[model samples]
Target: MIGDLLLAWISEAGNGTIADFRARAAWLARTENLDLHESATGRWLRDASALGHCEVDWKHGKWSVAPPVITRLPLADGLAVLVGARRQRLLRAIDEEGVYAEQARRLGSSRDIPPPCTILMPYERTRDLEEYAAALGAVYSGCAAAAIAALLGTTAPAKPTAPPAYDSPFEHLSSFSPQTWAPTLPSRPNPSEGLHREQVNGRWQHLLRREGGWYATDLSRGVFAELARRGETVIRWRPDGDHRTRTGTVIVDWGASLPPLQARALVLCSGFVPRFGSAAETSLYDNVPREIAARVASSLGQTLQTSS
Candidate 1:
């Protein structure tokens, strides 16, 4: 169940423990289609701990879930599965019906389809953290909520003719405007550096050696842009081969989406900067659908770069 995944993640976190995991918990709740406020995260964690799923030690500021040595315990019904199923059925029907209808009309259906470009949420005043967080989670929330709302069709948040800009969600995020929005190439590193792997988005991505000589990711431009925006200078990410990457000296946690780029960029709650760069010009992960791009960037620790 979704809740199980959330708990499992926390349990599998560094040292199999989570210290001060509020923001990430909030974001996870949204993705699971739970209308949970940030404050609710603690209650949820406590409830899970009480249920014998995890151990909560507030004094030490940690939540720990010790996996069963031999057996997996079943969890209760997590959320509204009926709603999720219905949405999936609807999407399938839409595609099937559209294809049949098009074929009847003697039109061809392309196997490769660019999803309908509809704004799920447009520019709106930051009324509250929930709304802002929801916007960031429009895609992440899946069919349980955000995607469901988008499928039902909603009005754009801003005027159709003019797109909108957004405030960076983090107070520490960079606020300076660039003389030129274009990315400055990442600084060079010593010749010893090379491509390495790092744990990101629940998986691993390569930290590549850039032309500038520094070991960074393929999407370094966007990552750097997000860091500068947040006024951050260093990325404390885990690389497969680097001892520093494994050390707790620096830790990264994915936060809310990059408001300016939405899912195109996402911040790490711990660092208050982007976890990966999102490519802008190409349709790829550097060139792919927004959803796929986000996943690829997550696995690889990068997203496409775009300007505000």
Candidate 2:
């Protein structure tokens, strides 16, 4: 079935569409003795999704797997070139185990370029058509093959690793040095011309009239810093009601509370009540973790002990 083929392709190739997958399943059944019927295929795919493998669909043009699979199987022996290419695009829309393996293709490819401190890829990198294509191909050809081989009962020798606590797959990501980074703040609105002007740094310093003339702080900065310090490198942003709170608290996906064990942090700024002011106040939050609760409790304990 179509779903079976897609699942096999996803399992074997990492991603595939209905037609492309069906064609491959037909070929594999006929040649490789892989008994993947349509019903069986769908069942396998459902199983794969339940087990956390991402389902990827490509709707562009017709494609063939026989030739490329044969041609690059040796030199580019590990990656899932075809599925990797298409899968990265899907990563933007679907969280799929939260890592978004397809999108991480570029970060692996551009290992030289220091990654930005944010979760989402920069607009320029994500929008670049050619770069995305290359990333897909690289991932497909590099990793997909090894994944397939492992599925087919082939085993490669394992590599050594550092200690468990010290072993972080994304340890390289933390090597970022903000000193070498150049700031690119968005342009601010001009009250004089009644339009957005080149004003920047709209943090706590910027006074807002819409906020009842209350000077606002950029809560994102504080949150980001806090999470980073706590080792939560990934975060998602959610806005709070302006009437309720000036800044929003950070939360994990699926409405989970911010974990004391920080892995990542995200900043949300929706429904913030704005106040009109002479200067802009956009630098309040930096979206990093601050460990405020622990710090506050520690200070309170010290004061109580002194008084007693």
Candidate 3:
């Protein structure tokens, strides 16, 4: 039950995809308040670990639940999600394959139940049919997964994949390079936006929601922060406008690259500055501060230009 509870806590923290020590400690304090008073709490953790219900990452000091065995089956022609009984047969079929499959139920588990099935494919607008499921049948599982067989498979032992690759969302600023990237502006919007509580992946993160947009991943934000530091600027969007419209997260276009960014971002070299927005006077050529422009280029924030 401890393992089950711990896994749930971990999952709930980061999009339910990851759990760290601080989160675990906090979760323990919250759910097992009585356990804290007992010295045997440590022994319980040891026992849980010995049973292979979970594993400890010593260096990082975190615990990780096993991830589901994702057996990729082409459902539709485009990406569509499966829900309810609509997702059952395929799940059962996959489960019958072997022990590596994840189960939907378990013992010694009061809270966390493993995911039954997860399918990703293109949507052809005809996926709901039972015939459709049987027709396009080239499914296989190549990923290293856990739960090792059983529909009642209780524990998920595999670790989640590493943080996604970093792609800067500020990749579009290269177009204005020939110019001074603009000379000046009346006010500059602060970049960091002063860290706020944000949900990332499936967990509670203290990062901004500059994302959910393609370029707003943690890696991108961190890179943006670094680049901003170099140029002494932070990468952020213009949150305020006449309509009070919420600009969805900032994004960099698909084909944009880094060279142009380097040219425009380097202060010492032949680079152009970036133009960002602010509270007071919005400038025609919003020259982003050196700090922020540098961060955008270096971090690859991949910010795009909107129509004037």
Candidate 4:
């Protein structure tokens, strides 16, 4: 009873993984009390394999191997190999003269891996299906798949095909050149405005949010420190007007969104000697030290005076 249920499940599934087969076995065991032991199931498969299979004949003397044959019937010129009620037709276009006859071709395999339950017959038996199936228990298999592969070369293994040369959509990006400019941070803001954070010499500070604008507070500090080094006490820092006020993560949330290059442009246009601390510090540009920068900050502070 378990074997019958197991065979039915295998037939229904067509092909399934070992896990799926085990699950089905457990379910059958629980529901029907029919325990299909894995070992028993394996033995049944082996027995089926020995009993018979199917085959196809590509051409006379040139046959296509099929599965183990359960039955073979001689047709007009060619033959038909049947395994478990499934029939494979092999063509033979030759006459009764036995001279060079027409060739025959087998249909493609019905399944991808054809389930371990089913085996693919070799090409030879299809020419004379009955004799070949009878000789199954006569020979053990050898390991020369390459020769078999050559015969089954209808679908060769895929090789890396040379890709056609095509231009990338962003190929023009290579033409873009990065602009370079000096940086100048303001020391004080028009007597009414001051740095958001204390100006520390030779150090990058925090980020700043002012007037609904996001500024790299570190860049501002570095600029101020550079100004101090040059004895430029009177300085003006102008945050870029084109930026979101929320402080965003450097590389992740908002790296490209911030106009670091535009900030450098503003500083360069302002005509102040720009200073830089190091390469790492200079990479982040967000504000310019200009006359309006100080004046605007000062005006804002006066309008909304903060005692802190």
Candidate 5:
């Protein structure tokens, strides 16, 4: 089932990095209120590649659907792979008695069943086969309706919709503040001045607007100092662990707001903030606010001069 979803997304997206796939998967989870785990997307991508349904470019770190001729897998081989993957999960679940107990109850077996660990005791792997089969059948039926919808094209890629117009850019920022990180303004005569001092005293920051909202990261913290300095509501995101070196590469949940025009500008001018140890920064999208765009261009020019 996951394999089918992966193929369909890859086909529609043409080609993308694992990060791109994960981003889209995150969006789907938010919009559809489904339990589409990001880790599962990466796992299924590898599975698809292994099954010859997709091709991976190791050097470029991109994936695309394989040629039709090489995409077919023998039914028995495919089933073997599915069973092997699922069996591992079942083995892990055997250690959690609550899982089997829930399944047993769902399968209409109210009588006290053997503990999950005991169900697969040494040399008795098939002792509870009937109970396991019933549990699996129940799960299958629960997802059958959604699976049919997915197969029938109801789960197509979302179309980019127009963002609503705002009287001021600040209003636009506020509209997405709930999903993205917005700075808490100080109660001062000139909040911008106070915010500027705070940001400059901190480490450099990076920002990117993708899908529909902004994602910001700072070397020392996950704040959008520059945007905050401008009284702009910038969303904040922190990496899972010590991932400061690859801050720009992290994927985050930015909600279901699809402000395409602003998102496109951010994508086109993604280099506005230089990466660590790199002297690259520029604004390529002209539609961005003039003052911010000018500063980005000026910063890039200064960097070029210093490097020269």
Candidate 6:
């Protein structure tokens, strides 16, 4: 039960440091009779990390976990993960394949018909039907579940909720060029106007929210126009107009509910040198010319623009 609680916490938090887990465990112990200590939590994390259930940073004491991706496997391999009444049901499904063959044929190519193992793998990996479908490349659509349903002769699961336009606070920042003026924008809003403006040096300089954070801008109409042209929602202040008020605030909404990028992107974007065990294994960014990185960055910008 403690192990289950730990996994649940990791799933909800996405990532956390050892201290974070320890504190959370303590709280759970007090409120929920979860009686796990810091040492127990640490041991469980280490074991899970060793088993490839999660990634860990020993030095910094941070760990992260993602839902497992679906991989092709045979029945023997599949049964190693499935159990209980579901296991018996899967056996029945596979045994009755001949009965469903005609039904499966009407759905699509017989060759594309997923096995009982395919249906069971999702159940073994996660209880989240959407995550299961997504791992099988169905995304929010019910296509993956439909395939499994055709095989099992059951109704397909409902389609997942549509993802939001922007998911992360960092996403809007990543849209701009890494080295450009846009990437330097400030995230801290001005207390008085609730805008990205601050008194810097001796002048009241305007700041824009960009790639990494807030950056100083000239506050030119042209700059606002350019940002708007780039598909950013720019709320301009009108002191004496209908949109004006001392209490008016600018709200920046991060859209699109996509999952955060994995550690590889975090490492590369932060300029970290990743170490691999074998000399033969090399980082993708290693020995690559700066031009390649720049080209990739430009392509990302283009993709964001197109999506917007």
Kindly give the stretch of ten consecutive residues in candidate 3 with the minimal lDDT sum: 143-152
Q: Which segments of model 3 are wrong by more than 4 Å?
A: 1-3, 14-33, 36-54, 69-308
lDDT, candidate 2, 1-308, per-residue tens: 33323433454463346565545546655554544445543333322321223332222322322211111111211221122122333434334323222222112111121111111222222233234334333222222222332333101112222221212111111222221212222222322110011223321221111211222222222233333334443322223344333223332221111211121111111101111121421112112122321222222121101100
Per-residue lDDT tens digits for candidate 3, residues 83-171, read 21222334455456432322222222122222222233333334333233443332223211111111111111122223222431212
lDDT of 4 by residue, 1-308 (tens): 44434544444444445445546556655675544444543333332232222121111112122232223221112323223322221111112222232222222122111112222233344444434434432222221111121232111112222221122111011110121222223322221121232223432233232333324333323233222323433222323333432111111011111122222122222111122323333322122223323322222221111111
TM-score (all chains, Cα) for each model: 0.22, 0.17, 0.20, 0.19, 0.23, 0.27
Number of backbone collisions per candidate = 19, 73, 43, 21, 4, 15
Question: How big is the RMSD of model 2?
Answer: 24.1
Cα-lDDT of candidate 2: 0.26
Best by lDDT: 6
lDDT for each residue of candidate 5 in 75-140, tens digit (9 for 90 to 100)? 111110111122333435544533242121011012211111101111122324334434332121
In candidate 4, how many Å is residue 139 off?
22
Candidate 5 wrong stretches, greater than 4 Å: 1-3, 36-38, 70-308
For candidate 2, give the lDDT of residue 98. Answer: 37
Specify the highest-TM-score model's number.
Answer: 6
Question: What is the lDDT of every predicted structure here?
Answer: 0.30, 0.26, 0.29, 0.27, 0.30, 0.32
- lDDT (tens digit, per residue) of candidate 6 on 152-187: 211111222222112212112223212122212233
Cα RMSDs, all models: 21.7, 24.1, 21.7, 33.6, 20.8, 20.8
Q: After superposition, how far is residue 128 of candidate 4 from its true place, in Å?
A: 14
After superposition, the stretches of candidate 4 with alpha carbons farther than 4 Å from their true spots are: 35-38, 52-69, 72-82, 85-308
Off by over 4 Å in 6: 34-38, 71-77, 80-308
Task: State candidate 6's TM-score.
Answer: 0.27
Clashes of 4: 21
Off by over 4 Å in 1: 14-20, 69-308
Our model 3 lands, by Cα RMSD against the true structure, at 21.7
